[model samples]
Target: MNTQSDIKLTDQLERDLIERELGTQRLGFVNDAKRVIAAVQNVFTRLQAEARKAKVVYANG
Candidate 1:
């Protein structure tokens, strides 16, 4: 089993490898993708906040 610190280190290594593979030329595209991901995450957070305010309960079908 991986420890929390070990998992974080592995994730960092993977991100470093991907950045190296993408290189400077594609950095702009990577930045754009990051921005889009951030935007989606923000939307999800807002939705969760709204659901909590409305006392929503999630059910599995």
Candidate 2:
């Protein structure tokens, strides 16, 4: 006994979910952004390690 509005709502949701799963829009950028973020984090970790190895600590006295 669903109304036309209800059917439309359901259809819209299905389409939205399919597009989201396929990453047809901004979701498509998520993987690329994650890769960039990970690369930056890796570089920061390496820099921190090098700084620690060299005992480079800033003391603002």
Best by TM-score: 1
Cα lDDT listed for each candidate: 0.87, 0.85
Clashes of each: 0, 0
Model 1 Cα lDDT, one tens digit per residue, 10-41:
99999999888879759878899999999999
**Tens-digit lDDT track of model 2 for 1-61:** 5798899999999999998878765666887899999999999999999888677444432
Q: Pick the candidate with the highest lDDT.
A: 1
- In candidate 2, stretches whose alpha carbon ends up further than 4 angstroms from where it belongs are 1-22, 56-61
Q: Tally clashes: model 2.
A: 0
Give the local distance difference test score of model 2: 0.85
TM-score of each: 0.51, 0.50
Model 1: lDDT of residue 27: 85
